[model samples]
Target: MGASQPGGPSLPQERRLVTAIPGPKSVELMERRNKAVARGVSTTLPVFVTRSGGGVVEDVDGNSLIDFGSGIAVTSVGNSAEAVVRRATEQLQRFTHTCFMVTPYDSYVAVAEQLNELTPGDHEKRTALFNSGAEAVENAVKIARAYTKRTAVVVFDHGYHGRTNLTMALTAKNMPYKESFGPFAPEVYRVPVAYPFRWLTGAENCADEAAAAAIDAVTKQIGAHNVAAVVIEPILGEGGFIEPAKGFLPKIVEFCRENGIVFVADEIQTGFCRTGEWFACDDEGIVPDLITTAKGIAGGLPLAAVTGRAEIMDAAHAGGLGGTYGGNPVACAAALGAIETMRAHDLNGAAQRIGEVMKGRLNTIAEKNPAIGEVRGRGAMIAIELVKPGTKEPAADYAGAIAKACHAEGLLVLTAGTYGNVLRFLPPLVMPEHLLVEGLDILEKAIAQVTA
Candidate 1:
């Protein structure tokens, strides 16, 4: 990561803190936000971004911070890549919206075609667009139910789908995502996930034991015949960057296929080039019956899609599967640009290189600090689970403190986990190596400060 991409923003690629974190201007903005915005919508860093491109985000107070979150894995390509800006600007000049449902557009169809061609499996496929990951997941469930003629849907522990009524039921977290928002959709069941870090049977046995437990739960509790689909994240996002044990996904997919249950991969966070592949499932050669994508799909534009086997996707009624803003022309243009940029830059390889650098640095840090329970993930989607020294007990406070310290030092990082002890890194694929190493330096200092 040398510098900004060609024709990207010209801002310097180094971290510079002119004022305290959430400086005076940001504090004033926060006051206005508190008065006007909903209290439920929270801010992580609260610095108020004014400009951003490549690896740096500039705040209103003139602070340039190294961005490691990438807007939660949405901007795999740099935020203002030339293609994304040019395409979206052209599309905006042409038209913004005509409602794809009322009057279909070529951009929407083109996006669908691209998804069909790019997604795993050579089988004939169809795609439906949506405004968010939750909507894609909701539609996927609908398609599965329509195709399989079943009601119950199965998910795994520590999996995060979305925040809607149905998705809240699909998501496993209970505090911020699912608390009091209940009366959630029914007929959703949760089963064991192959989490190697915390699995009692040991890492070697995690995949087999967890898969067997999941299969048993579905068969005995939900009844295999009643399951419409088995939904899972290739790598859990908000639930922490937990990569399932090797061989677990294949077993679950096989069981789903045998039971006539549709297999859905929620690739919202792990899709595109975030995991060094087109999708995380590709690592194990697992092609889901339905794949839901968002986040990195459109280089920060609000767009999500579900791509699946043709017959299954076509099961929904003609008028039952679209929204007003689904595949909005501008978003479609942005997605096309994002896809083009991914190929042009070989962002998949970039993600792999980033992963190599990060994993090497993080592993070294882990070796020096016993509080880091584990260093796990693939490509740029990596995380460190913090724990008490010499024990597996979660140290959520330590994780939070480290993240805050990084923020204060003008390096933006994010935290996750069911127990809230994971510090995850999702840097843009366009980030320069120097910035990444610099960010890691800040993180090391923060971790040392917290653990000491």
Candidate 2:
């Protein structure tokens, strides 16, 4: 039997390495996948997953690996959570889809109600459901443009929105996300973010100088009157999980407010107790005009939402929004169950505790390893930047080596960052303390071996 985790029930929680990491079964599947799957669709860890619950993912190879990635922060309440499974199963037994737009469902309305009540602001709010983060973000921009009657959309460096054409223009990274996929949608402006670790001057002056520089550029170049929205990730997700300098977001929020531009918080990775709060915007009390959410919202189900002020949401014409499979009944049910699980288990507290534990361990690791340039991020979404010793040059090679080492040892870790030099950890909040410590121990060993 598996030990229980914080958020919900679990599978056999121990890390059981049977054969090797990619055992015979996984290797066979990989060979099959190589033939069937498209080359464009890549995988970080190729072990075919059979079951995942709480803090562990059981592979077809009969190995149970510690899940620190959480399906790229999609399983915040833990994979195959009890509530999610139960609710989704019940919904599946009934009606699978009639489509919310085609025929409304109570679960859709209920999920929207929960979102309206839970998202940052107290003002009257409305929520529109979509199938993915990209759709939600795309719709948020559309709503903003509709409300403001403007064309330009301002985005920041190191921000990751989604994979859609508009969001590809909004995202900052190249190579994987935007390389050769351009001739993207126009009227999207990119600006600087207060990335203290890579700031030109110094970390202390980063917030003020970077914010001022961003505002100045937006004003002079983009012309605030023509910009409909300023989209930013509260804590960057795919771009290394960089948390902007403390006062940075608030300054941008203020600027957006002054210019009548809808401030959109792309909290797809930072929301749903992942950042020790319901939303990252709550940390600094920075409310946005529109907030896009996904990833953790439905405990691994494909459900996304755009939640914002009622007036702003209503600005779109009657038939301007929605999709055929948007807010599928089963996904909506899973979302409600996920929300219930989060509240019932105090996942926010669980996330805060994870942050405390991870920071304490990560700080000690950074102290011993000069390759670790910086340790930053909040709650379950922690990351460490790798750099060359005695220099700021990104150690992307070291990052890759350590991650490979961890994979060989049965620890599931993910690499990120624009420079490809960041090791990001998004442990399930429900992960038991022992597993967390074990994962860290494996990481420490990998770091020592690789850096040495």
lDDT of 2 by residue, 324-383 (tens): 999999999999989998898888999999999999999998898898999999999999
Compose the digit string of candidate 1's lDDT tens values, residues 38-117: 99998889999998888999999999999999999998898888899999999999999999988878989999999999
Residue runs of model 2 more than 4 Å from their true location after superposition = 6-10
Q: Give the range of the ten consecutive residues with the poorest summed lDDT in model 2.
A: 1-10
Candidates in order, TM-scores: namely 0.99, 0.98
Q: Each prediction's Cα lDDT score? A: 0.93, 0.92
Clashes of each: 2, 0
Highest TM-score scorer: 1
In model 2, what are the clashing residue pairs, if there are any? none
